[model samples]
Target: MARWKIKNVSVSGVAMAVPKNVVKTAELGLLSQEESDVFDNTVGIKSRHIAPDSMCASDMCQAAAEKLLEELGWERDSIDVLLFESVTGDYRTPPTSCVLQDRLGLSENCFSMDIPMGCCGCMYAITVAGNLLTSGNVKRALLLIGDTALRMGSMKDKSRVPLFGDCGTAVALEYDETAHDIIVDFHTYGKGYEALMTPHGGFRHPATPESFEYEDFGNGIVRAPIHTLINGMNVFSFAISRPPKSIEKFLADYNINRDTDIDYFLIHQANKMIVDRIVKKLKFPQEKVPYNLEEFGNLGGASIPSLMVTRIADQLRTKETTLLMSSFGLGLSWGTMCLKTKPMVISEIVFL
Candidate 1:
């Protein structure tokens, strides 16, 4: 129930890095001909980038952050805060953000932390970064969020396998005293936490040999508890329900006109179908909703930033537009935000 407005912060730039490897849902033997057709035509997944086995999520993030730092001409020491948001970290201990600080050659004084959440993470990281900058002590922050959700599922599991992609992104934010406020509305429903989770890898179900045994979950879907478990129906229900409702309330409460006040509605690219449903539910214009999942599948925490970089980089670089973003995912957590974007250096999507 966190409802607040934060000011004095603006996103300076956004950059994303995805693996060079391409994976088409059609190419993966996981889906049958009909499923593949549906996935490509209606569900919006055509191809996705898959990191090599040797690469971890942090590697992609570091690549993105490295390029962003260079482009923004930001010296390593000037970044006072860095937030890494993702469930897939290099290790369970030390927190990935701390490790990234060393890799990126950031100053030891940087306040770094990890937000171990998926999908809705980028915005959450922005929220944390904004708060820190407004505290009057911090100047600049690098907000990184992404994961290898595509790597979490067994290759043969058709249902979940084709629906995810691997990615890493960085959204740089700096304090600007005259910047307009960012309004965000947050909602949490712990009841849906189990709807999307790896039930066997966390503390309560720490890795065990028995956990590696694959079990069939019907509909040609089979996986071990160690793999990411997504209850499609439940997740779909939550996605199509909560985010739209929350966004409606967000717009209404702010007296923002969807048709005139906002230039774009950049939703977490879960899929074309889900975005369409939300669009249909809200009676929002379809043309203003830009999407990239058609080529990249669903990129977990990286979706929003990736979406911005891939689909609207040029517009964001030159136009001062109003945007409303809605993101929802695991934790049954979701949020809606509206901000008038200033000119930002949006880098082209990088394939590492």
Candidate 2:
């Protein structure tokens, strides 16, 4: 059990940018009419945004960051640290964050790096950013999370392709002497690493032309070894257990009530079945837990922040809110966090 109480770190702004190319499941010929209806109702994914081949994860991240920096009216050089979290970076070398620093025109003194994580990426980024701010070594930090990898998925994979959307988010955090503490808990089960993975393009399995060879497993899902693969059953089992339990324990330890103490539960938009199961197990009210999966599908680690920007931007901008965020999947990691926002700036969801 890894837990931390971060003080004097608060979010100043948040912004999300999704590719303009909207793709509804119906748009794909792979799914039957009945299957499309089932996916829409059960998965809650009516549509998703797909980035063009020309657009990389960094492009959307840069878009959101530029807009957030502009909206917050902060000088680029004022940012002291930047972490770019994503599974599909522009390249395998020269850390993507380094390119982002140049794209955003940040100071040469700013510390920049990349964190390669999937669904758990954003929460991990935010947690790390908060801890760094605790040291008072940095005045402000930028956490950029998103993924364009789904666009790289094999088009024939009926199971995983429709479950994803491309999105990038920029969250601005600054050191504050008076802000309340941010509580976070983390857990991992590396044994399930194979539950969800892309087997090639890494040093362990360098990409080869044969990596694109197709193998149909008799199931509807087809994968080229290089494409993302998922063990849906195992992933569903993991999601329905850890996330709800961790959050329940978090609220219990903090003496916070699920009914009222927490203003909202911004969980990873994995799917309707997984999300509804977690909510029911925790006994949290449905109204307080909003879902964008119907319109945005799963944005991986970007889902939580993307949910805030796309669904509750007005509420977050108008009043102080206590947010309970939970993230799980890929790396087989799960994390739950409790954060209080003091009416920060949340920009309109940018489409590009």
Candidate 3:
């Protein structure tokens, strides 16, 4: 695990965009009534916004960036950096950031790049952008992070389909001399990478005949190597273990009082079970923790910002809110951070 304190950077605004299509678990037809009820009550997913085949992660992100830039009254030309973070990109090549730069009308000198990450992408991307800005080399940045997890999963895979949603979120950041410092702690477990992965279609295992073969895992879980596959037991175990420990250590190491210093705990919306466990272990009041999983399902890297836009936009828009954010998933990695956000522009949820 590693931690860093980034200074002179502040969150300016946040915005989120989701597909117009809504998939309610009860209507998915993949599960029986009894099963659906159990899933709703346990996993806590009621519906998920799934993007159509025609819309990619980049499109949603572009919409979000447009709205955010307009709301923040930020000039496109002033953006010194643009970070596109997500596992899903517009294409396998040409890097999605290049496309976004052209689409968003960023200046030719803008330092744009892509970070292929899952749940922890937002924090990681923010940390990277903060570094770029701290040197005064980059003045402003647009951090676009989200994923269409369902687009990568088999429609027939009940285990994954109902728990994943499509969302794109944009966060504006700028270098400010008076801004409070941002503390970030990041950790990774490479040995547990297989806990959550899309087994094929990478340079690693390149496409093989077997990659296309779909196997029924029984009980309605069916998928191929080309689709996202999650080892439930492995992920659940890791989620309930590592994240809480990291959060506690971050608070203690930074001399932060989780109960008082933090105004909100924006935890990753993995699932009710995983989230509930972590909150319980940390002994934080349920009211301090906000969630969006019930309506948007799990949005990978977009989870944290999506929560801000959907659940606590009012608070964030009204006053400075100290936040303790924690995220864990995909690479079997987790991150925890403490930051303060002044009353900022948090736009209404955009449905595309």
Give the Å error, residue 55, model 2.
0.5
| Residue pairs clashing, model 1 | none
TM-score of 3: 0.98
Among these predictions, the greatest lDDT belongs to 3
Report, for every candidate in turn, its global Cα lDDT versus the true structure: 0.89, 0.90, 0.92
lDDT score, candidate 1, position 50: 85
Give the per-residue lDDT of model 2 (tens digit) for 202-229.
Answer: 8899999999999897657778988888
Instruction: Estimate candidate 2's RMSD in Å.
Output: 1.0
Worst 10 residues of 3 by lDDT: 250-259
lDDT, model 2, position 307: 85
Expressed as tens digits, the lDDT of each residue in 1-352 for candidate 1 is: 6976988988899999999999788788878788788879988889989888888889889999998888899999999998999888999898999999999999999999999879999889988888889766899999888898877887768888888889999999999987888998889999878899888888899999988999987888899989988888999999999888889888888999999999889899988889999999999898999889988889887888997888888889998978899899989899998887899898877788
Worst 10 residues of 1 by lDDT: 150-159
Clashes of 2: 0
lDDT by residue (tens digit), candidate 3, 1-352: 4788899999999999999999889898899989999999999999999898899999899999999999999999999999999899989998899999999999999998999879998999999999889867778999999888887888889888899999999999999988999999999999999989998999999989999899999989999999988888899999999889988888888788877888999999999999999999999978999978999999999999998998899999999999999999878789998899889999988899
Candidate 1 vs candidate 3: the lDDT winner is 3
Model 2 alpha-carbon miss at residue 238, Å: 0.5
